[model samples]
Target: MTARIRSVNVGASRDGVGSRGRASAIDKQPVASVEVRDPGPKRGGLGSGVVGDDVVSRRHHGGSSQAVYAVAREELDHWGGVLERVLPDGQFGENLTTQGLDVDGAVVGERWRVGSALLEVTGPRIPCATFGAWMGERGWVRRFTERGRTGAYLAVVEPGTVSTGDVVEVLERPAHGIVVPRVFRALCGDLEAADEVLGARVLDAQHHAELERSVARRTP
Candidate 1:
């Protein structure tokens, strides 16, 4: 499926459902619809050499309608294939609604092109309370972080320019043979699952340290 740059609004909510209460009084910045592209030198550089491009500036709650990119049914199907599940129409909070791409399997430091703009998978989503609140679940954030299924974060690698209906291709997966889920599970604090996650060696330094800690804890 392909995704297009749609209007983006970040107020205390994406749906504009609930009031931001006093939060808006302090920091009142209306989220604007920005064309998804490599934000250029004004934003950052495009490559593994550019560490500053790692910053993710947007965070929205509820109202999924006004997001970075809006996906059509076909694009959703593409994302669903990667997810291994049929996704609801227009149900992603992505700046780039991608199709035929396994976004989750993308390991750290992989880049792909969306139209002319290049985006790279740099990190995973950090579960937050607002997301849980938006999901209408009290503990969704905890469960989400614990599950470690959050999609990876993408950094603009090449400052081309991205709009809607862009076809996304998988430039790379972990050639290291270690999956992201394995790292998350190994550090998820679930002993049984941790064992399975740590069953294999992970290249991430943080994960390797955690595995060592887990082994030490179990030994005693």
Candidate 2:
């Protein structure tokens, strides 16, 4: 199967897990069409998170580097097998559930032309506590991190509407070998590997800073 969008999901306001009473937009549903644009900075910003998508936590999500998150259907299937359940599209709270795409293998600076918009791969989606809560699984964060198939987070280079069935065309790939999985591995425990991502010229500035900090902490 060719690499194409199987679903476009947008989040809505909903109650979160645990006793925090926090609102979460993790329960995204498939949408027919939605606008894609840059969500600016991480804190106190608005960007492309779908027309009706709710970004409850701006501090760590929904920024230019994370304007969109995508996961391969194949990866979802793998997780389903491990979890012993039929994983549905958007179950990971991904904006795009892609088929026949190696999202984890995509180079950090790679550009994908989906529909009328252009998006650049920035990094991997590091599994967080909220993600674990949503999955309602034990040790999900560690399991997901060790799996190293964290999918890809993308930045919008050109605003446009995208929907299911849109062909994902790779417009460019960085010369550096810093792919999404490598970055995920680096963030998980191998900080030295982050040097590879630091070499990508087209990497998002925000991600660059975070990786730089991680690298600095180990430098002594």
Candidate 3:
């Protein structure tokens, strides 16, 4: 089957699993349809690109660079086997649960036409404490990082609606070959991977700053 959205998900913030009750929408629920648009900046601007998708933690996630998150259904199934639990659609807070796409291998700067929206590849979805807490697994963050499947964040290039089964077609891709896996490895302290991913000119300014600090802090 061709790459397509198996489900579109969105969620509102829920209490607990964080300090100061830092609400999270990581437990997203599948939706029949939703609108996608550029959410502009993080703080003052709208947090989520998908209408009604809450991004409560503006200090960290959401914004133009991370307007949407996609994870492959194949990857979720793999994790299900690893964790010995049935992973459901939107289990990882992904806005789109995709089928037949090598999401982590998508190069930075790649453009995809999904539904009526045009989306651009941005960066890897980094793991955080809240995510680990939600999973209820020991060393969940480290485990997720070590597994090297960070998924992919995307920015909406054109405002449009998306729904389940929308085909995800690659409209364009840069020659740099800096895919999401390499970028995620860089974020996880792989020095050589850092150099390779940073070589891609398409790395956005916001992501560039985060990558630099993460690489430096993780490097021994």
Each model's lDDT comes to 0.43, 0.84, 0.89
In model 1, where is the ten-residue run with the lowest total lDDT? 61-70
Greater lDDT among 1 and 3 belongs to: 3
Pairs that collide in candidate 3 are: none
User: For all the candidates, what are their Cα RMSDs to the real structure?
Assistant: 8.7, 1.7, 1.9
Lowest lDDT 10-residue stretch of candidate 2: 195-204
TM-scores of the models, in the order given: 0.51, 0.93, 0.93
1 or 2, greater by lDDT: 2
Model 2 bad stretches (over 4 Å): none
* Candidate 1 similarity to native, TM-score: 0.51
Candidate 2 vs candidate 3: which has greater lDDT?
3
lDDT of 3 by residue, 49-153 (tens): 999999988878999999999999999999999999999999888999999999998998899999999999998898998888788888888889888887899
Residue 81, model 3: lDDT of 97
Q: Tens-digit lDDT track for model 2 on 1-220? A: 7899999999886885522657788887898878988878878778444567778777778888889999999999999999999989999989999999999889987999999999999888877778888898899988998888998999899999888999999999977767888888777658557665576544566666777887888888
Report residue 143 deviation for candidate 1 (angstroms): 4.0
